[model samples]
Target: MNFIKVYTLTALFSAFTLIQATHANAITAPPLETQVKQVAQWFTGLFDNSQQVATNPSIPLITLSSCSVALTNTNPVTGTENIYLEQKSINRFRLYSFSQENSAVNLSIRAFDTNYSVTGLCNRPESEHTLDSSKVLATSCNLQLLWEPTDYIGNNSPNGCPTSSGGKVISSVTVSENGIDSLDKIFGANGNLLFATPIEFRRVDSIPEPSFTLGILAIGFWGTSKTILRKHKQKSTVSEESLFNCD
Candidate 1:
């Protein structure tokens, strides 16, 4: 009996330890690429800054031209797929290029200004639907951007990007399905805050095509009419049965 008890106790302890280890792993497991993909969807739409700029005078009056997230074939050498974040403005354009590396994401940002005809080149053919190197006059910065939860936070690489604006910039952006909030700061060479902007952008709703909207309305009306007819048929059947029973 004592040997039996000892064996059972050992089995229970082993099971308990296994369970604890599995629970710990589940809690501490690194985020998957799918999670990042879902988060990217939140940023994949056109956002307008007009209302935000109007409400907050401190923020810059720059407009947000577009924000998009898509899968691209960028690195032919490695043959690895990557998620691309393209953000464009009136005067500046930025691309956050990222790929899943093991359990984490490796991200980098490339910035361009109006001097480089980025917008035009992006529309041109044979550019792989990417930036055209021939038209690019100069690249402003190439820095590593870090990802956390729903945010991408990073600063300019060490003396990597010298902006014509005369300061190093640090960017912190919080993104969601509804809108985006950004706190962008530029510090002078002396480490003093030269400029700061807190901007909010709201997502623009895509208007459905008139034909699609009409089709949906027609389907709804048809379903409603069918339901009404069904009820009317049931009522008529019940009245007919009553008359027959009275006879």
Candidate 2:
């Protein structure tokens, strides 16, 4: 009976430790604020096709400057941020709003046209990086991005974003710590590919990769707990044998 009790207790303890080990190994995503900030940081940079254009000169000299502006008033994500991206190649501008739902992050994009052409807007002060809600157009196709290992990839549904010319647009964007990849396709009403621009860019200013945080979280606690639990089981077995054998 005593041995049974001890064995049962040991088993329960082992199970509890295993649970801890599992929790330690489990990848718990960061809080919404932290995650939003991280994505915003990845997007806010001067990205140009310096390397890509060198290899294929045909690729357009696309310089994308994105900056994050903290929302103060009536935005969907008022406290988070609104990302403003200016494409220097074609004098185009875009606005992005981000929100989090569970483990996924959503990106809401809109084509913004101010009264005048805006160039080098990202480099300006934070106060000047915004526009009134009137400048924001309504495009309901929000890209649901998933963190695929090291990159966030997402695209709109088929014929989701429509062009003013009554054509359809399929847009895809990838955000990575290294850089950004974006491709936009405008299909005519007849399903013919009218225009497509695939742009690959590397951050002009290099930044440290934040993957080490996940590596440490995934390996640090569970590994130590697993080792200690194994040693503990071995010691407990040896102690029990010696205790019973002693006359």
Candidate 3:
């Protein structure tokens, strides 16, 4: 009886230890703010858009070098903050607004013609007529980025965006540790596909190594705990069978 009591207590202690270890190893996602910031940082970098024109030869040939996304200031009136300014060239730029909606990150893109200058009769003075106050040339499709276990998949609204070229543009982007994949489809007013292509941009930089190391460590700990628990269970079962046979 005493031996049985000792064995039962030991088993209970082992189970408790296993539970504790497993709980500790469990990885919890970072706060929404942190996630948004991380994603924003990931998006801000130089990219090559040459592949876009390569995949679709019909599209007008544009300068593909020096494509980049940079952080910008928040809007004061409309509160429609400009999180990232995506510059394709001296003439073409896209202002992006990023926000956290529940567990997902949403992106709204607005096209701008940086080459154009603001004329008089505008609300802001000529001195303040910068890209921030520049008229929105076009509003692109809204994009929602769904977070996966390892990366993010993004899709644009099917409604599409009307352009000055008398067509609508639809876009989708996928972001991962490796890089970004972007797809853009332009349809004419008659609903004829004008230009469509997918472009892959290699990452110019990577996320901090400490976060990755922590994730790896957590996975290892969880796996080790599971193995330990399984072995403990097998040993407990064998010991119980031997004790029963003796009895």
Best candidate according to lDDT:
2
TM-scores for candidates 1 onward, in order: 0.50, 0.65, 0.51
lDDT, candidate 3, 115-198, per-residue tens: 644222113442342354345544344666776655667665476555544655566667666566666565566877644545
Worst 10 residues of 1 by lDDT: 215-224
Model 3 scores a TM of 0.51
Off by over 4 Å in 3: 1-29, 49-81, 84-91, 113-131, 134-140, 205-247
Clashing pairs in 3: none
- State the local distance difference test value for candidate 2: 0.54
Better candidate number, 2 or 3, judged by lDDT: 2
Cα lDDT tens digits for candidate 1, 198-231: 5666666542222311110000000012232344
Candidate 2 stretches with Cα past 4 Å from truth are: 1-28, 70-79, 113-117, 207-247
Q: Which candidate is the best by TM-score?
A: 2
lDDT of each: 0.40, 0.54, 0.44
Q: Name the lDDT of candidate 1.
A: 0.40
